[model samples]
Target: MKIRQKSREFIWGIYDFADTIFSMNVVSLYFPLLIVSDLGGKDIYVGLANSISQLLIVLTAPIFGIFSDRTGKRMPLFIISASLCAIGTLAIGFSAELGAILPVVIAFIFANYFYQLSLTFYNSLLPRVGPESRWGKISGLGTALGYVGSIVGMILVMPFNTGKIFGLNTFIPAGGRIATFTPTAILFAIFALPTLIYYLRDERRSKYPVDTVNRHPFKKIWETFSDTRRYPGIRRFIVSRFFFEEGVETAIVFMGVFAEKVMGMPDSAKIVFFVIATTAAVFGSIIWGKITDWLGPHQSLMLVLYGWIIGLIVLAIFPYRWLFYPIGCWIGIMLGGVWTTSRPYLLKIAPAENVGRYFGLYSLSGKAAAITGPLIWGTIILIFSGWNLFAAYRIAVATLAILIAIGTIILMPNKTLFEKHPIV
Candidate 1:
């Protein structure tokens, strides 16, 4: 990477790190457990609640995307949305008392809405800052660093229950649940601050800009949707990724549960598992990103998918907690490439003017799909406590592999395919 590009990637990575903490602490690791284990909500309700939140955003995000497209702005949306989510995270931690499932639920919905909306706009910039050749590397680096944030946030919070820097002693005894509550809130606020601050001051300008927010948000939204109709490759990419992303989301978000509920693992074990995965992701992202420069995004994606699929299969068949390291490492590698590779790849297929609109739809599919994993896996557990985390993981991976295979067959790109019809 050139010095200038490296500089942009660094700032971008910082934003990703700050923002990804929400996914790490609130959505993936801590809050879901807080809801299920502590608040006594069933997985069905948990899943339903999460699903609805995405659905809510799904309804309006494309409109926001269209507005972003019309105005050719990404930073403002990212700052506002991420800030909202950061605040909501604080709201969530404070709502964690035993009797306040309702409050927690409300806060969760709001947090997801803003976090996702922020991502829709954040992703719009993928194609803008970096060279097409280096898109994969750039995106991968940002994503991997984002997961690193997850690792840090979760690690920081573990002291109360787990003891010591390495142990679960993060909590200050007398602070009780409030202690946990305050730290998570403060961290969420602190963690997301960089993203909002940097975005507000960044000097980058969109090549496309317009005066009006969509006069007909829905109709204009449809226009944004219809714009993609001309691109067969983009369609296939969406369908393939709709499945691929879910497995990634499921593992990152629900692994904590799988550790405790199904695998009988401790917090320390969960921390170790995620930390290993997080570390692997950091390196894997760098490697995959570089590969994208050499091989193109699609080839880079295929390579990562192959590694990811193999890992899923291994975990399914082995079903051993000890194997989490190998499997986690496998995931970490491919995991880095997913958002890193896909968004940039999709941008290559989209229209420059519609990056926000299309990316919004792109993110929508993944978030909409996200609700299913928790619901299905959680329900399966309710029925069969004997079912292991590995088995559930296998199912998720297998489903995605099938989707990827079918989509690959339909959308196989031979170099010239994307050049003539860039996504944006």
Candidate 2:
């Protein structure tokens, strides 16, 4: 039993490793560059693509959550959404090859929507992976492995762009930015197979069973929205998450573009920078996971938020080429810490029976923030386009810093709110 459970935990974590490959390579790094630099599009196209996909996720996430809760199943949905996400990602590569910006954007939007949608089901699987006491460590392990995936994904995909693996010339034809998409889609599908197979075979039901006969997903969404008042800190936490996630999501979408445009880093240098940053994130996720266990997720999350506020401000004002490495490392650490703490934090505060619904709200909060955050970033960039381009990008970073600061303030009072919940 112990070995089986441990295997289950590891397999669950592999999915994190799998999905993040798509996120790091496609969403965060290559796709934006493909849009703006290679295809002659603007920042707004990238932002709009992200926002549109997020809007679709936000509209449907709650309903998806309610369905998961009612049916007491997550794996089938996870597999279906994840498979579609891979297909969509492959379509992106094909569309880009056609040399049409609109097709690339359309494919990206399709890929991103399913990618985000899959996370709604994926996140709710946390409780099934381990006992509640181990949730923090387990979540951390998954996040750490995810950063590792980012590192590996970057290295694996680099050959496509550079035509060389580890500084050696290779026969693999360098297709530049366009070559990145197909392999990324392939990796996403390959790595995801383990978890999909594991869950399909296990066929276990959730501890919290719901009335399948009296299903009312839409009404349940409303009821869950209203029922948050009963959970004490959840409403406040979600609200706070909305504000901070806006900053985080915007950064993730624009960071690659910012590195290229503002810092004038070449693609190879940018890859090195991200690897260093992602390494820091790997360590940070592991350390912060322990901290979440020791300090409790709420307190730990506050510390992570404080780190974001400070880091974003420094990142905005000081855009020196020399400082970019250290600052990138800092942001990467906070990025790992944020997700590491937030997942268990939600699990800690909410009742076990409604985990799916609340995590849906969690996804909803983040996706809603995602919907506006990129648009806000694009608007800021557009508004200041007439000015120095570098200055405009810096100003956009400063705006995100302010948003993180506001989220910190709102989250501060939640130390007391947790006291009202019995789980705490």
Index of the highest-lDDT prediction: 2
Lowest-lDDT window of 10 residues in candidate 1? 170-179
Off by over 4 Å in 2: 204-208, 211-215, 417-424
What digit string (tens of lDDT, one per residue) describes model 1 on residues 188-302? Answer: 6676666556655663532444435546778876666676678757766776766666566666666676667656776667778878887888888888777776667777777
Q: Which stretches of candidate 1 lie over 4 Å from their true place?
A: 1-5, 160-163, 168-171, 174-181, 203-215, 383-424
All candidates: TM-score: 0.87, 0.96
| Model 2: per-residue Cα lDDT at residue 374 | 95
lDDT of 2 at 176: 95
Best by TM-score: 2
